[model samples]
Target chain A: MRFTSAQRLDDGVLEREFTLGEIPGTLWTPESAAPVPLILMAHNNGLPKADPRLVARARYIAARGYAVATIDAAGCGDRPPSAAAEQARADLRRAMRAGEPLDEIFESLVGPLVEGAVPEWRTTLDALLELPGIGGPVGYSGGWTALGIRLAVVEPRIAAAGFFAGGYVPRAQREEARQVTVPLLFLLQWDDEGNPRQRALDLFDAFGSKEKTLHANLGGHTGTPSFELEDGCRFLDRHLK
Target chain B: MRFTSAQRLDDGVLEREFTLGEIPGTLWTPESAAPVPLILMAHNNGLPKADPRLVARARYIAARGYAVATIDAAGCGDRPPSAAAEQARADLRRAMRAGEPLDEIFESLVGPLVEGAVPEWRTTLDALLELPGIGGPVGYSGGWTALGIRLAVVEPRIAAAGFFAGGYVPRAQREEARQVTVPLLFLLQWDDEGNPRQRALDLFDAFGSKEKTLHANLGGHTGTPSFELEDGCRFLDRHLK
Candidate 1:
């Protein structure tokens, strides 16, 4: 069936606003399926809600019969309250009051603008999980947004996570990788020249989970692999299925 | 000192070649210095000898009081022979017959047109190392080319290595990491979607030297920290000094 942003429950396609508490997101799912696995796809840093990468990924996974929800975290994507320096300062103040570190404060504030439409993302994920056909394992991809989802969602329904050039803040959170009982996959480049390689390794090493797998490619920092989607499919299939 | 092509070395601050053997590269050194430590730098794939990135890097390193050399590998950069399908096919055949990789074969066939440019990167390193007053650790950066240098250089003079998004290739020549006995510092990105995180980890883990360290940053692929050169200089100072 054709994939559109509107909600469609019968042909296994649905798009609607989901609310995680007060957080909102845009959800997409297969209408005809029942209790199928769910995937929480987060956008890359600074990507908009309608980013082609996120949209394409959602469509690809949905065609595979899995429910995919793309969320734009706070201040990101289509969320209102544009990312102005003044707004950022206010968000940072709130995070600081919460005892969160500087990076987390920055992440919570500017993350949305750098990720996607945030309100739609939170609303979408919540709505998708409540659907009859959507349940079971949850996976996350993209970068900063994925890390945000990990913080917001603690449901047992999340069975696995896949990071596509995304990671968590406060360094210590990465140390808690083992706590994420689900399988975790990290994709990176060797000749990136942009991103450092050591931190990714440290995170992998700190991951207490035995299901963690890492794959390296020859591409540079903006290079996408030829089989990234297929690889993601296989990983989700193995864990969520 | 001014940097110039091999043909203009006589008139410039430093004269250099892009590669000494089957590799492609550029060489630069202060015309006033009696002799200096030769620094070998590798470029990322698809980058030519004259790429602005390489030029900037070379110029920066040269200004830092080291003799800098940068090279483009085969199949890319300021050297492309015959750009014709039939000629390219013939060139490949000749290289294979000569027991060389395509890059080496192409370098040999197009030596005259490209001015004896080949993938003799290691040979150049050897020549540089042998130069008077060049005694000390050799430093390298870049992606695949850095790895290539690590594989080919057998000299004991290479006291340290600083890798920037350099580790990506699979283990080909029987435990490549075991050969690296010098201090190594690796810089990586936590959210790199391009390179495989595991391969970088494998390389870090394989480093038998006791002085290996890995550092991670929050940036995505190719994310250079606000002070990358400063950090690199610090790392080099700690080890190469």
Candidate 2:
């Protein structure tokens, strides 16, 4: 791990950019010197780690006294693009334009992305935990929902998870949801234009966790109510802090 | 309207038992001498206003500086029973015992009950608001959910509502849900044994509120997490206070 740059923000949060091997990422920590639990924020597909929404979420949760980190996915942000992923993206666009069924297209696009991103995230998690001022029990939050699900199922360090359910979830991943047992807070936008509502509800049902909660609000893909930020913080506090 | 009994509880909540015409009810108010917003809690079918759960919720919300009130439905609590309602209950039991289709039986049971209860609730609302220390902008919370939908659609005074989606929602009431425009906090027990989870999700979808939220927790009908009480209070405070 190598630190690329660091800046102190007006809100007293320390924002640092780093590179783990080839994976670029950012970390945000509060002013508190005491080690705090960490949150690994997973961005929506195509959203870079530096996207404003992810940055705002990172800052807000860090302000609540937790260290927050997010890393660029396999072919996103400052990283080299994958030829296969670009081909899948073009296929998705063509399928959508032709009003064709998109199950295979989505599977081709998101399946490998998740397959590659999950290990990168776990590896990043490995390095992030080794850093000073960031401590365990970690929480996995936000989209892609599939990544969160995979991590919640396989990552023993993730004590809790909060997922945004507006992203494409591959069919095999939906089946994998039955293996997740950690406490979960799943948020769904009832009117999210880009996501199928039934698929989201079905995924919420498939979670095998004994303490899963789904907070569905009326809104488009980006219209999740702002109050959820604090709510997610409280959930993390209950489980992590 | 007549006050049948009044007692000041140890927690500084003023508990009052009252009757409006043939309807019996209870109200809980904080120690505040000034007026406070009111929450008209609708009890689950057959659970009466004085049910322990209802009392606990009322007192809890009352302590939050809001006056909370609940009243007996047409054939619940100290009120006289209707022979017709008795027949419907018997039919419901027989259908359940035989694994017969229950749509008509549930409709017969809940549809008229809501019809009769909505007007009684409105009349009680009139009398309660007229009383000192109980102010405008009432919130309707809890079940029978059909009654809440009816009251929310027909009563203009209710500013917000929090619904428990464990009760059987008559098909007609599901249709009426689209007309309820107030901000809503809908709670669903994802594994509620007595309630169909898909129906609850569908009803939540049909609600027309521009600002509706569904909070689905993993539990049976009676297992809503305790933090939801405070969550609901904050929701009401957002619109009612």
Pick out the ten consecutive residues of candidate 2 chain B with the lowest summed lDDT: B165-174
Kindly report which residue stretches of model 1 are placed more than 4 angstroms away from their true locations once superposed: A1-24, A31-33, A82-126, A145-153, A166-168, B1-241
Please give, for residues A59-172, the per-residue lDDT of candidate 2 as tens digits. 999999999999998888879887888788888888878878888889888988888888999998999999888878899888788888888888899999999973469987
| Pairs of colliding residues, candidate 2 | B43-B143
Instruction: Point to the candidate with the largest TM-score.
Output: 2
lDDT (Cα, tens digit) per residue for candidate 2, span B147-187: 89989999999889999974478887888889999999999
Restricted to chain B, the TM-score per model reads 0.68, 0.96
